[model samples]
Target: MSLLFKELDYRPTPIGVLSLRRRRELSLDIDVYEIKLDDEYLMSSLFTDAEIALADLGLADLAGDSLDVVVGGLGLGYTAKAALDNPKTGKLTVLDTLPEVIEWHQQGLLPLGEQLSGDRRCELVHADFFGASLSDIAGMNPQRPDTRHDAILLDVDHSPGNVLHDDHKRLYTKDGLQKLATHLVPGGVFALWSTELPEPWFEENLAAAFDDIRAEVITFRHPLIDREDINTVYIARKAS
Candidate 1:
C-alpha cells in the first residue's frame, strides 16, 4: 500500500509542477491538474552515469566549434543538462512526448533546466521522439545542416525489452532504427539509456541500420535515499 503523499520538493518548469512524491517509495511525478509518475523519483531512475555517457558518446567525436545534440527524453533534464554543460556542445534540443514534462522544466521543477535553458543553448520541444518527423527537427533550427544531430540520446522507456508504453517498442524495431539513422550525421553516436541490457534483436536491428553498431554496458550506483541500485547504459554509434 502507498503511504500518505508527502512532499519532497517541487519545481516550476515547462511541465508545470515537478515534485518529489514521498510515499512508501520516493517517486517523481508531474501535474498540471492531474498527477502522473514520470519515473520513480530519486530511485533507480536518476542514473548520472548513463546520462553523462549519453552526452559524451556523441560529443567525443565532433571537432567543430559548435555541436548540436538531440535528446529524446527529458526525464528531470539530467542528460540534456549534462550535454549543455559540455563546452563542445553548441545547442541541445530536448524532445519529450508529454508537454507537462516540458512544463516541469520550464517552470523550474528541475533546477538544471533553469540553469541551462537560459544559456541560449537549450531548446525544449513537446512531441513524441519516435513520431517527430525530420521536418519537425529541421524547423527547430533552420540553419542546422542536413543530417544535423551529432548525437542522439534516447532515454524514452526503461529499455527495449521492458517497455512501459507499447508504442515505444517501435524504437527498438528495424523500421524505427532506420528512422533514427536518417537523423544522425555521419559518425554520429546514438546512445540509449536502458534499465538493463537490451535483447539481441535490438543489436541486430541497430546493425541493420548503421554501419558500425556497438553497445556499452555502464554500471553505476544510484543516489536514492533508501536503497542502492546499479543501472546500465547502451551506446550505439553510426559508422562514419
Candidate 2:
C-alpha cells in the first residue's frame, strides 16, 4: 500500500461487502476515512456536520439532565461522539446492524473509535435499529430492553423513501411511527437524518405519532467538490 491510501479493514456483511479505508488528501494534507458498502460510499469523515447536528438538535429540545439517548447508526461514530459531548447525556446507546462496524470501534479502527469506546457513558451494540424501534416489548437499548429513551437519533437510510433494506420502509409509515414512539418517553425526541429534502407524505405520517415536528436543513462544504451540500434533519417530539 502506498502512503496515500490504505485499507483499514474489509469484511463481508449481510448487506454487502463492507470496507473501511483511510486515504491521504494530497490537496488538503489530511487523512480521510471512508466507509463503503459494495461500490457505494456509505459515509466519510470529511462530511459530518449533519451527523453531529442530529444529536445536537434533538438534545437541544429537551430540558433535563441524565438524558438517555439512542443513536441508530454507528458510522464513523460522529453522532455517538456528539451525543456524549453533551453534558446532559447520561447514557448513549449506539446500534448498528453489522457487528463488524461495532468491532471496528471496539478495536479502535476509526478515528473516533477510541473516544467512543472508552467513554463511560457510551455503549455500542450490534442489533437492527429499525427492528428494535418497532418492537413491542424491547426498546433500543439491549442491556435495558424495557427502558425508554429520552431521544432516538437515526442516520441509517438515505431518506424516508430510500431505505437500505426493504424492512426499514415500514418505519416511515404512520403505523410504524406510532410503534417507534412507544419506545420513547413522553416528550422524547426522534431525529432522522436524510440525504435529501423532507417529503410531504413522510411529514404527514410523522405528525400522526409526534408533536412539534421540524425539518432542519443543514449545509456544509463538500470537500471533494468544493461546493455546498445539504442534508436534512427531521426532529419530532413525542406528546408529553
Candidate 3:
C-alpha cells in the first residue's frame, strides 16, 4: 500500500499554531489523523486507547441515570465521543480554549467531528477551562450559571507537572484543584489523563483538594514504536 501524508489545516490561534495532519502508518496499515499545537503533538487517532479510557474508567464509579459531564479538552473528539457512548450521559459539554479547534469539529474537519456535533448531548464551548475555577466559574456552562456536573474529564496538558502552556500550571495545584471541584457535584469525579507516570506528589496535591484520590497507570502496546508504553489517569472524588 502507498503511504499517505498531508497537512489538512493550519492556522494561528491564541495558544499557538494549531494544525491538523493525516498520515498513514505503514506498520498499522491504516490512516491516522493527528492534531498538533505548535511543535508538540496534541493527539492522534491511531492511539485513542488512553483517550477513550479517560472516559470509561473515569466515569466507572458514577451511578444512577441522567448524567451530566464536562470534558476539559476537545482534542480529536475521542473522549467526547466516548462519553456520549454512555447511555446514562444526559449532556456532555466540551470546553476548549481554542476557537479554531471547536470550529474544526463544527466544520467536519476532524474524523469524529461531524458525529459529535450532530449529537444532541454534545456541546462544544469556546472558553478557557484552566481559567474557570471557584473564583471565576463564569462562562463555563455558557447557557446556565452554577452548573455542576457529575464528572469533569481533563486531557489538555501532558501532566500535572508538565504543562503545554504556563497558564495551565495552576490547574494542577491544590488551590487550583480545589477550585475545580466547585464545578462538580458533591460526589462528582475529577478524571485527568496524563502522559507522565503516576506521581505521588501530584496525588498529595489531589488529596488535599478532594477525597478517594488514586492514580492508575495505563499500559498499552505502541504499534508505531513496537514497544510497551504507559500513561496515567488520576481519579478523585469531591466531598460527599
In lDDT terms, which candidate is top?
2
Error of 2 at 169 (Å): 0.5
Clashes of each: 24, 0, 0
Sort by lDDT, top down from the best: 2, 3, 1
C-alpha lDDT score of every prediction, in listed order: 0.66, 0.92, 0.86
Candidate 2 stretches greater than 4 Å from native: none
Q: Could you tell me the lDDT of residue 227 within candidate 3?
A: 94
Residue-level lDDT tens digits of model 1 in 35-60 = 23543332223446776777766566
Residue 110 CA error for candidate 3 (Å)? Answer: 1.4
Q: Between 2 and 3, whose lDDT is larger?
A: 2
Q: Write the per-residue lDDT of candidate 2 for residues 1-240, one digit (tens) a residue.
A: 337999999998778999999999887788999999999999998899999999999999788889999999999998999999999999999999999999988998887999999999999998889889888874788789889999999999999999888999999999999999999999999999999988899999999999879899999998878999999999999999
TM-score of each: 0.75, 0.97, 0.95
Rank by TM-score, descending? Answer: 2, 3, 1
Model 1 residue 20 lDDT? 53
lDDT of 3 by residue, 1-240 (tens): 534898889998877898998888887788888899899888888778888889988898999678889999999999999999988789888999888889889999787899999998889998778877545653357666567889999999888888988888887888888888888888999999999898888899999999888888888888777799888888999989
Model 2 residue 143 distance off true place after TM-score fit, in angstroms: 1.1
